[model samples]
Target: MTPPEPLRDVIARHGLQASKALGQNFILDRQLLARIAAIPGEIAGDTIYEVGPGPGGLTRALLDRGARVVAVERDPRFLPALAELGAEYPGMLEVIHADAMRIDEPALAGRGARVVSNLPYNVGTALLLRWLTADWPPWWQSLTLMFQKEVADRIVAPPGGGKFGRLSVLAQWRSHPSVAMQLSRSAFVPPPKVASSVVHIVPGNAPKDVAARSIEQVTEAAFGQRRKMLRSSLKSVPAALAALEPLGIDPQRRAETLAVADFVALARELG
Candidate 1:
């Protein structure tokens, strides 16, 4: 059965507009929802972790695809609607009312599960960072998420690019990421200011000698100032030189100039 569109009209009638602070942009297109769900390689029979299933739009889409959805919604305003969805998809939609950022995600994706969502533009970067550098690799397996086009560029950026920053380092260090789909502003019920795209990331084992922690530390320092070179930027840490020494990365080089692997190496040397 096609999911309910009438609920959206009802939601708007009640003045339940998308919250900019929460980065809530509801997806009304059925085909788009299906595409987002399909991001985690072979989602069939795989459990899905969905953040912010506002009015159960994406929730219904995931359920229709036979994937069990663990939706974490923060807004109580939509709980009643979600509850109704739970009834419709028995033993499938597990709705939790909480802030997705604060909630422990790996704990949520028990067994063979995947991260799938039209991510809130506001918290998208934070959530992506948390999941990408997770301690365990097969924890969620893959992430299919939406972000502002700019954020998407940062995630998939390479060395010496403007989008390259701590985010670029962190995301590329752990996963192979790519933009799967782009949606225009017109796609939403009440359009947002910026365009958005779905980013699909497959988290696999890191390359040899890349400690996730070190990459994090180095990237933080490098992108902290963002204007200064590595040597100048890392002045906060007394042992910064020791960390950057072994990697053969120049102290004069800017953070954005370094590739993901270089950042990983520098991070390891930090200790």
Candidate 2:
């Protein structure tokens, strides 16, 4: 395998191509990858999970920064190139051949592992949902992830914002989410049409007032008809509103108007 080069040259040398089907876009920015690795504390002694690390560009950066990276790559075509990375890092890189969607991450990560990846555009939101919706907090201690700019906006959306919706509700319900960096199309080898942004989330224990899964269900139903008033929109979730009866929730309020605590109360009421 050829040694990596300036991000663009590396792509040209190996006949490397981005697969639209896989939602692959190669980042040429070394500093950005390093920044991601650094976000969840020092890399050393930390288990870092990177999904779809095509060509191991980010893998190299993670390893160089001293993090133990468990890289799950779905594309076998990139295996040879990734094998070279494993060779270089030796015990530091563990490359798995599996669809990230199907893999059992909790078992793989054990404890103290963090999910940090550039993320495959096609499956990014789905994967984020899985991590955020896990039963216990700290399933992955934190998430340093990339998403299309639109998704990023949703992740960091504040109450009453147009971009705020289900993603904002779910993500903010457990983790303190923020946009760490904004990336341009030119950063990737095959420039994507839209800009991208990196989101960093550090999950904490949900307040004792609510259960995690319950809030999830309530938010799903409430935001499902996000534009409608809660009284009208949440009518489908009689159980949720009934649960909130003691809390004196105004049935007419919409999902966006409700805070995370309110959703938790509604979720509990529904349960």
TM-score, model 1 to reference: 0.90
Q: How many backbone clashes does candidate 2 have?
A: 1
Model 2 scores worst on lDDT over the 10 consecutive residues at 2-11
Cα lDDT computed for each candidate against the true fold: 0.78, 0.82
Clashes of each: 1, 1
Poorly placed runs, candidate 1 (over 4 Å): 1-7, 10-15, 208-210, 238-240, 243-246
In the range 144-258, model 2's lDDT, one tens digit per residue, is: 9989999999898887767878888788876799898899999887899899999999986676657667777777788888888787667667887665556877777778877
Instruction: List, residue by residue over 181-246, the lDDT tens digit for candidate 1.
Output: 898998886699889888888875677666677677767877998889888988765465566766
Q: After the best TM-score superposition of candidate 2, give how far the Cα of residue 179 lies from its true spot, in angstroms.
A: 0.9
Off by over 4 Å in 2: 1-4, 243-245
